[model samples]
Target: MTPDSPASIRPAELAGLDLLASAVVLVDSGGHIVYVNAAAENLLESSLKALARQQLAALFAMPQELEHIVAQAREHKFSDVRQELALERAGREALHVHIIASAMDRPDGAVLIELREIVQQMKQDREERLLDQSQVNKELIRNLAHEIKNPLGGIRGAAQLLEMELPPLHLTQLREYTQVIIKEADRLQTLVDRLLAPHRRPHIVGDVNIHEVLERVRSLILAEFPLGLTIRRDYDASLPEFRGDKEQLIQAVLNIAHNAAHALAARIEQGDAEIVFRTRVARQMTLAKVRYQLALDLHIIDNGPGIPSQIRDRIFYPLVSGRDGGSGLGLTLAQTFVQQHMGVIECESRPGLTDFRILLPLP
Candidate 1:
């Protein structure tokens, strides 16, 4: 065969294959790396050219299970196996990766191994678990609402009766106290209604232009807090309309943007508050453990004091709030509404910057 012929080409040709986002390494019989692909460079945090002649064991310190798998692959003509290995990348903590090994038929007696970061797998697992937990909570809330609503009405009625019996001067104070209780009970009822709204109403699935949602939210924010605040829109015009529950999605986006506006109060007072509503199309996204070709990416970013460190971790939990006079149910309801449409909401916050990203599958 000629030097340029495919059959006579070097083993590096494996790099040209359209592999998944996995680290691929080609190692010879003695376990010296003959070739490494771009994915491997990212996973291992080392350049492929620099690692060409390095021994695999020296570079990876593979786990016993992975080493055993590789050994078996060497003994057998071809073997495919999966195992987890802990690898330390430069300037990063040690990460666990799932390694899949298979023997190759190259004349150099090389084996091809693919590695995928276990962290991404774990994130998928966690997202599924959280979705299940949220579903359970929704059922509990529905049941509890049914159980509480009847007694709540009776209590409010009894309060009214007692106020009517009191003396004129004392009646005013008594009614004031009763009013507070009734007001609070009514507020709880509203919350319960909001929680049940999505399930009770038919999903109005339609071709939703995401930019319209952002525009409506921006106008509302500007109207409410026009002074010392700026609203920016960074939308991708090429994005297509997505099939989604329009009202529910509007509420979800509004809740997040409202929370950001509240956080920017001090910044607004200082005339430096900025809230950005950005939209894009994510090429590949896994929502609720299911992968899709394209998904809507909406970001609500604010240059505020950021979320409080104390409640940052539990921001999505019901009745958790960092601001005074905040209902704390906005985000919880927002999350519930989005999840109903098979989406996920994620938050990343630090001092002076807080971002809430929502991912919804496209039709």
Candidate 2:
């Protein structure tokens, strides 16, 4: 192995890089690609063999900026970090990426380049914020539920007593007013119970088939919207089962699908409503700051008017709803359920497409 030869770094040593969620590329002093990790292949939409000996800067729209960073790393033997760089591919959309270039110890002045998608970084940051905010929101809701629960019972009892004390026949007409009060109290009580349900329910863990959960949700959704709505399935049959609460997962998915159905009301009336349930195996996925070798990527997508942008960011927060008269607990409870299983749910929406993606780690 000559000191000037980077060929001394065998493929076996680079195998570890494949496990990383971040894209990595190794460039020799001449700014030619020597090695590319699996994540890099996915990001560049090319294979390692195809990229071997290719100029690293050629893959990016701003080649001169990339080349300058690589040169600086090689000359100073220091690391350089740049943000919001565009990586262009022939048949795909340009990627906004954050690039990190660091000089390696090789005698040939080989440098290590790491690429992270800006959108993905922002998504991860949002997930972390959602998780933290959810904890505080749950606590507030639980306390509020308890407070409301006590008064609800009292209000219902008082209303019942007032009805009983009403005059026999003529005042029976006045009993209707008391009945309304009692009924509204009971309704509020039910809402309070649901607010505290997640904290009160026991997590029943067992081997769960994600497809089964999806099928159950599909049936329930179709049963409700039998005529106009269509539920499509795109299943990856190779996905493995993992430990979780099957019932909780079903309810979680059903809640999201149900919301989509309601959001698609206009299309449903026109007999064009469509909701797709897609399942795929994700490799080297990071969920809740932990990187997993494999994970389940489940998407519930609907072709509707899309979520109103005003409340899109807070959809998972308790009582935040985009639709009129919506209690807003569905997505919040779905997020709580997924979080219990160490998973996270993210959403993307536009004028015609709304997608809710749930990521769950698989053992």
Candidate 3:
């Protein structure tokens, strides 16, 4: 339909489509597009007007099979029929989606198709599992920290006492070894304290503007990587302030940014390191198996040699590290802080791109 056509969809109807989170595409019996919702436009990477001129077969992997399914649904007056299908889009990888097709009870015999990517379902499952594992890890680390703390104290005290008792002749060389023992024991003591800190620390809640937190981290990161790193800000100015611990949020973002900077050392040296801090309001978001009506979606992305795939799955686990000499506690601590605020952090990485996303409830 042309812009001047009276048969064109009214603005009120288009506004209704914009409210839907699911990708909804309306197709007529003759296999032509009649209407495509905002979500559908994004999923299909085409404007509604553009989609209206395209054939339905141009979007799916096996058009003939979908045509057959639609025919059976229409003949039987079936509604809410779902099928797993793949979408075929030019110059892009085919998306594996679960499609729900409902034959509208209209004379035009239109079909409403809703698409949800299968990978998103898998990621939801992974997020739930990761949260449960994080809880288990916290318990294990607490118990282990206590158990390790007592022995460390004994070793440090014994070493100090032995150092004091050493004779003058042999004291110098032996005292050096005792100093090493004391230093290592002190380091382990510090590690254990950090492992238990979150559990013991009091929660300080207040209204937090996410941008403010990002600014704090930005200043800190830029100060350290002053020469060769660029930290880009892509924040949503209209984001509402939410209640959370400002200090914890700062630490959480700082840890992730610091880790990204560490991973970008080579790129930084070559003067091409880039990190992006992005924020957006997500509607109808699900995190850790719990659905929220609205949420804060924050992404920390880096352009560096990405994380190793071998250890990618275990990156959030305590004490796991890809870089040599890394404590591997940065991400773990970051996850802990965000979890305390009823949020979740997830990572996706590959060669040349590494992204960490944080999702939290919004008012």
Candidate 4:
């Protein structure tokens, strides 16, 4: 619907758009900005009063395509979505956004526009993919672990019997071979146990202070890298204690911190490696499609060579690692523990920076 005049557009209707997360703007047929919502004001970094009456074309680096879309939208009385538009700002870098223009039912030929950040959209998609992939990986690992576990004990027992029967004479070689088989079987048993650990462990719920958990991990990591590594804490003291398994949380955090410390080997030897444990309360946070009033945002940041690009995307998968001689199960277990507590572990890495963020819903 097109409005014949700007005065005919309803301010109350436009004000309701502020509840949306997407930036919303209304422009008349003359391409003059008529209304801007709170999200738009925040995205544009300009107050509504300052934005009103400005030329809508001025907001975009190249407005020709947007103008054509708006014209088509107005003529067809429908909505049009365009991807990857450069939103120009006065000083800051141009933002990549998806623009949706819909013809408004008004007398002045107004068009309502919605802007969504492309990066944020990609992040949401990534999170969904991670959650889905983790489920499948966990199931596969558990089944494979069980299948390997049953045969391991039989192999170990048979090797022990063979060793006992062969040592009656000068048979050192035979005994040594049996020992190797037994040792290898035992090693396989241990690996299988670790794979099934998350499923076997019981959920021991207790009041969990996130800072306390971080402190435990910090002490353990510092003990291991006593010479050059420094662990820093940035805690939000006002955060309330939540119910979770304390031991599992400790292991989850320790795995990540330990991985970071190992990655900082070069900097640690030079006496300049640092890892920061930061915690804060997130309001109106959503996890796995479930929205919470408040959640705990914990970040484990490190100053080190970033995670290897090849394994960056699949780091949480079992047997995926970046470091030499790495078991690759640390992050898999960490993710399992966090997921048990209804949280997610997300990672971002670049040269000299690797950040692991864990988001858990708070009471």
The best candidate by lDDT is: 2
> How many Å off is the CA of 220 in candidate 3?
0.9
Number of the top candidate by TM-score? 2
Estimate every model's Cα lDDT from 0 to 1.
0.79, 0.90, 0.86, 0.87
lDDT of 2 by residue, 263-331 (tens): 999999999999999999988888888898889999999999998888888888888888889999999
Worst 10 residues of 3 by lDDT: 1-10
| Candidates arranged by TM-score, highest first | 2, 4, 3, 1
Taking all chains together, the TM-score of candidate 3 against the true structure is 0.76
TM-score of 4: 0.85
Error of model 3, residue 302, in angstroms? 1.8
Per-residue alpha-carbon lDDT of model 1 for 1-363, expressed as tens digits? 432223443656674643444578877766767677766886777886788667676655554555677888866735587777777666767788888889876665567888888887777777787788778877887787778877878877887787778899787777889888788878777876765665688878888888888888888889999999999889989889878877888888888888888888888899999998888898557798776768988888999888888998778777788888887778888998888888998888999889998888887
Model 4 alpha-carbon miss at residue 323, Å: 2.7
Indicate the worst ten consecutive residues by lDDT in candidate 2: 1-10
TM-score for each of the candidates: 0.75, 0.89, 0.76, 0.85
| Candidate 1 Cα outliers beyond 4 Å, as residue runs | 1-71, 76-97, 102-112, 163-174
Q: Please list the Cα RMSD from the true structure of every candidate, rounded to 1 decimal place.
A: 5.6, 2.6, 5.4, 3.5
Q: CA shift at 58, candidate 4, in angstroms? A: 3.3
